[model samples]
Target: MSTAPSVTDRPRRGRRPAAQLVGIALAYFMVLLDTTVLAVAEPSIMISLHTGVAGVGWATTAYTTALASALVLGGGLADRLGAYPVFVVGVVGFGAASVACALSPALAYLLVFRALLGLFAAAIIPSSLALIAALYPDPGARGRAISAWAAISGAAMAAGPVVGGWLIAVDDWHAVFVINAPTALAVLVLCRTPITTTRRLRALSWLPHLGLAATLTTGTLAITRAGHRSWPEAVLFGLVALGLAYGTAAVDRTSSAPLVPASLRRDRAVWTAFAWGAAVNYALTTVLFSVPLLLHATATAAGATLLPMTLLVALNPPATGRLVAAHGPLRPIRMGFVAFPVGLALVAAGTAAHGRPLVLGLGLLLCGLGVSWTLPALVGFAVQHAAPDAAGSVGGILNATRQAGATVAAAVAGAVLTQDRGSGTAAVPFLIAAAVCALGLAGATTRHLSRTKEAPVADHVAEARHLGHMSRTSDGSSGELPGD
Candidate 1:
């Protein structure tokens, strides 16, 4: 087995560690801000580009599909090339793509640029997580840093709609894309400090990556096409997606260095984290999409209406971090699962009750609280349990699942709404989202109770043994130490 350089062994540059953390968080913030900003600007974009509803939806789908598909590769690249360099390149590429998007004269050009944006976003997400894991070796400090990162994402979600709406009103839809340039540039400036490099792993086969991309793209298209009542097209796409999934699995089982390592695939905690992350985004995005439709509000009004919920989302993470520090990750995560579904049920009830703003707002408040509490815990747990050398890969899997959840949200919401455009139909999507949350809650509860029953060190040691076995099975290698 090849011994990689440890993070502690690397030399530090002149910048303070705090500054490095902030720079990484800011980079993540740009991505989050772009997502919410686009949500608000979709209608304006449709109008400006003279496109139909389907075309407008593609703008979002293209980016998300590309992002989900490319994530594992990004993780692999980060682990090989060093997270700092990968992150820097991603930010620069993202900025250029954003500028291209702003300048696009046609809808096709816009779509192309948006896909490029996703490619870069895929790179940024995993690299940032890997860099954090490397920088803060202490578990407590790392948990807090991850929490802060989650908090910044929440802040971006809160700000995006309001900011995007105002920008659209003042200038045009292009202004939303234009804003990312300076933000990315600023992050680039802050992250000038040198980062320690690690030895690159042997090149993995690209077949799994290709299959993953096909699966994501076809799966998303199938669902969205079904929403539009294009049954034949949907069926064809669904078949293709299924075939790709099978092919990917086959490749994973045979490859010496799979995109998702065997050790990670065997960890229940990692899967639990992935599921919860996906469920949280599924519920959140469902509400974010449905409420706007249910109210039939203008972009500005929609932004205003959503403000209270997102503000809570932004503000709650620091306190949640303190909770994690004191009580451990499971408590807040469990709480989030319960609250998320309850919040969705309330939203469904509110929509059924003729769109009462107060009722809707109350539901949204719970949703925000749920997301704020759960997100940090989910990230912290995943990183903590993962093999230290594979931080970027683990991060990739986690974020890929989350992005897939978002894609599912878009497809499900689109289908439900297209079938029944009435305000009352909003309840159906929320109820579906609630079901997804309940499944996540069940998974979390099982893991939490199981952990409670075992001595913590015993559990860790068992997991280590399992990882060791997995590594040996994969390629006659020993496992790296589990990260705290």
Candidate 2:
């Protein structure tokens, strides 16, 4: 087990290591940009591939389903392997996959490569955060870095449409995939810093992992088919999906080595965070998927339309940093639960009211506020409370829920809006999103109220407390850096 350094031995910890932080942030930025940029590009993809909405929906489903399915396993890998090596492999593999995607000749080829992208992405996501945990061993430093890292997502969120539009204008749908290649290389170079090596003999259950992946993928396909109004196919796939989920759970129940650790399975905060994450991404993915399609927007026009919401995404983090410093993480999260539903409802109203720009813009603004307020804070909250060695595992689980939300929203939006591509159908998704957020709000509030102590308070105080608590871990390893 590691212990904190003495006052004399304490590392300066004055500032975040910029190169590593930027590399970590940029890796996630590329991932988010890929998602956001592709939202507008979906129309272009449909046109280029000579496919209808359902085909386009499958393309997205293939990637997100692969991601959600593989993340927990990825987390385990990050623990067994060192974070740095796992992260490097992910970056290299992601770049190669991006190149393969750019070269694909048909939708089938593209779908295969897209799944590869998600697979490599699974490696990157958990390990990158674990790298952050190692890089900033001080909870105080790590919290700020985590916030900054998450905030950078707003830049990607904001840029996705504009960048996608610009690239589409310059070439076509392939440019979006091609851009990732260079970005991946840059991440590799920037993230070359040597840090602590954390390894664990974490148990991995492949059968359960495969079962969960199948469950999500088949369920997604069910939603995709149901969106096209193929009730028979939907029912078949849905039943299969349910069967897979049940089987996976049963296997997990009896397994000597469960896919997820029992400690994580028993954590109330983790479960609540999972639900909350799902709610946030459901609203987000719905908007990203539907608006451009319903409005019949070109890339540039879609960028302008989404700007109001995306801009708010960028603006929220810095303020959230201060808000987190003062009022604590829960306030922003509560505020977000309120803002998300209202914004979604307004977006639904705007879509129903003849695609009114004013209403849509206002609604998007609220959605942005909701995202900015909640997501970074949530990241900080989860990471702050976790055991250092389990950082990757926690990151994986939290992101798995978030990605699961994205996958479900994409499927739901595809099913709902793809059916008609009409203003009426557009309103249905936002309405549904609002209801989901309301449930999240209720759950989160209930959790806060039931707890006796506001233990997950501001990072500075929490960090000090955590340092005192885990100065030496069970393994008796030092949670310290060379100097810092």
Candidate 3:
């Protein structure tokens, strides 16, 4: 077994440790909470907005698309500027947009503002991860911090429904989003100390990234509108296809600052990690978005109450996440891989049985557990292998994969689930999720996770030998202890 660097001499200085973790964690919690609350409130939004399936779907997709497209830029900008200021901007902007979403009079207005929210919210994850990377310079400490970070996010996902449900039950659907404002403001108030930092120009171009976003946006619109007979729909589909093709070409030609970093693209471990992370997020988002709708649709169709269905869907996230932490990411992820299909099968069986809420909830819980398990591991792997100077770039790419993957999944699942206009559509998304989880499992079994233990400990010396790679490759240069 390769030994890690000596623990006593790792770099651990310049920032208050608890402050870094607390500030970043609070920021992350708000993001996760917003996503979860929105997921459960989808049914309420559709009813309140008097919109069709497309309108409800856009509520989630808008945030994800904006978030994914902006993440890399957010990270690079943070590096160029400073994390604290950028982070505060993201917080205040997201909080302000939450108000916009809450007070909007029309679906269009809400979506426009939601997109704005996503743009600013995009800064949070990359900034938080980069801050953590800067603050905790030791690998072991960083890993543990990430694990805690993941745990907090998982907890938030679990709590989303309870809070959303309470608000939707007692107050209004808009209140679900409105709650973010005060919480974010409080976090911002606490984070007033600005760290002095300068922005660095990344070698990559933004055109390819823009192309990638255009591809996803257009592709979603194409898939969603596939059933329409209108000439406008056809034009949209054609445009989407063109954008996808253009994005593909752009990625192939660019070596510097492509949507995906060259390091991630070139490294199998990193690339595989990216693919798995995308797949997991895609499946998770599909479930989060679709399951509530399925339950409500079933309850409404059958003239049953909505409470039972809501409760069951709500339980899956936190419950499964806690299970994942206990069992380790692999077992839960594998189980999630296996369990997702089981949940889907239950959904299929339940839908066939005319909206059995218990079965549906059980299925969702299984899927949620699987997602929580897989996501942390993928994130952990990406951060673990990143080159020192490239932490922001790596974090951005990984987060982009997550947001984009979830966006794609949400789009495809929406397309699939909206077809029948019945609760049976629930089975469609569940099936797709099952397929995604299976793909994740197949990828997991490949050499990636197993190879982690065997990676060279002499990587620091090897990295030092490479051109332009000599600055602080590993710990021990600053006389600070690891895990301090």
Q: Write the per-residue lDDT of candidate 3 for residues 14-42, one digit (tens) a residue.
A: 44666656666777777777876776677
Q: Give candidate 3's error at residue 360 in angstroms.
A: 2.6
Per-residue lDDT for 65-178 in model 1, tens only? 778778777766766677788899999999999999999888999989998998898888767766776677676676677656555544676787798778888778899999
The true-versus-predicted C-alpha distance at residue 448 of model 3, in Å, is 9.5
Per-residue lDDT of candidate 2, residues 1-484 (tens digit): 1123211222222243788789877887787678777878888888888887767777777777778778777766766766678888988898899889888888999889888888888887767667777778776787677667756644777788899888888888899999999999999878766545556665666887788779888998898888877899999999999999999988987775565555666666666766777678777888887777776767888878898888777655666656766666677788988999999998888777764889989998999888777765665555555555555355456666777787888788778877786667769988898899899788768845347244554544443322211111000111222112
Rank ordering of all candidates by TM-score, starting from the highest: 2, 1, 3
- Score every model by TM-score: 0.83, 0.84, 0.77
Task: Candidate 3: count the clashes.
Answer: 4
Q: Over all chains combined, what TM-score does candidate 1 have? A: 0.83
Q: What's the CA error at residue 207 for candidate 2, in Å?
A: 2.0
What ordering of candidates by lDDT runs from best to worst? Answer: 2, 1, 3
Give the winner by lDDT: 2 or 3: 2
lDDT of each: 0.71, 0.72, 0.61
